[model samples]
Target: MQTKGSLVGDLVKGGIAGVAGTWVMGQVTGYMWEHEDPAARQRYEEVTGGKYVPDRTAEKIGQILGLNLSEEQHSMLAQASHWGLGAGVSAAYALLRRRYATADAAQGLLFGLLFWAIVDEGMTPLFGLAEMPQVYPWQAHARGFVGHLVFGVVAETVLDVFDQAS
Candidate 1:
């Protein structure tokens, strides 16, 4: 098993990386909207269920990074990038909890998805942290469900590695 210290390292590294990576991905989405194929926008929009607004996405990402991407498709790409980052965070947290059974993974996931809603959809837009549109309760659930499940699985796998080491 990894020493407890290493586990903590994983937790911190995972969380920090999740946040930073998510931010960059948001910006990248903004870039893609501007530079990518026109049909890409329609595909992205269809996939995102019309939640992909290029201007708002660009505004949100620019607010976080202090940069501008006015193109519609690049903005969409950044928003799209969030799927992986969200999944990574979920997976990392799941692993952390697995490593330390005492870790409150349920709580972590609850706070995480809710945070995604309030912060990503609610507070970010509320405070102009990001210009993205607000999410409804159901959408929050969707984000929570997919994200937490992925996280749980990833975390379980990580713990399995520890078990092997032990």
Candidate 2:
């Protein structure tokens, strides 16, 4: 049996992941992404008449990091990631509260992000601990900034649910 797969626990954990990741990425990599550039991707949406736009994590860190996910790609990817994250965090949060309560889901969400950015990212590419080789558009970043927000928000909600339980 899983010890902490409940809604609250998962949300709390996810939130922690976001904040922690944000901090470390900012400090270590000196890069943080929050939104897509209006110039490139924004124009594409206008041209294609696409309804979706890329949203950055903190503020598209592309300029700073010199890594290219592009305006169009970022916009589409962000949406997919956001959806997945929301689902994952909410599900986890609901399950967590069945067993216990924690007064720190928001903090938990933050921590989860921070840990993933600094520790988790390196696990695959850095240490080769295990090869996850490839991931989908959203999965590549779910654990990044996109997923954490889902974690934080959902976890916070789950914690509130736990409060009701008690």
Candidate 3:
């Protein structure tokens, strides 16, 4: 039988694992964003009528507050939200895993896809921070899909490591 304190400890560990996963995902995304073909970036800009940048956490936050922040500030805010969301998702995953013993790659992939659906395709568009995913260039969408895939995989791996260590 698991103690309440143990459960809470697992949640904290899982959240940290999620942050690690998010950091890895962020690096992959940052590299892709930096090295994407100019033509492809141009196409994205044309379709979105805005700059091509991965992770619109700041934009969504700004939209909610109706504040137009500078580019640097927006980037900072985006990073903060991105990490926070990653941790929250991981913590929730940890709790679910503890209950269901569903700590595997397939589940992680599903979690990532779920996030893509809810946050990327749903909330962002609903809040006017982004257009519907369908409207973006196919390549852009593919990139995002892969990034989330990495996030899920890494998060699950780290969570398992934490479990083993404990």
Q: Using TM-score as the measure, which candidate wins?
A: 3
The best-first sequence of candidates by lDDT reads 3, 1, 2
Superposed on all Cα atoms, model 2 deviates from the true structure by an RMSD in Å of 13.0
* Per-residue lDDT of model 2, residues 4-89, tens digit only: 44455656544543333334433432222234344544443443344221244312434446767766766666655445444454
Colliding pairs, model 3 = none
lDDT (C-alpha, whole model) for all candidates: 0.49, 0.45, 0.77
Candidate 1, which segments miss by more than 4 Å at Cα? 1-49, 53-58, 63-66, 70-100, 103-147
**Tens digit per residue, CA lDDT, model 1, 1-166:** 3334455556654554355434544454455456656665555455456643334455566777876665665566566555544545544654545445543446544545554555456654565434445323344334434543434433434444544455
- After the best TM-score superposition of candidate 2, give how far the Cα of residue 137 lies from its true spot, in angstroms: 20
Tell me the TM-score of each prediction against the true structure.
0.40, 0.31, 0.79
Ranking by TM-score: 3, 1, 2
Whole-model lDDT, model 3: 0.77
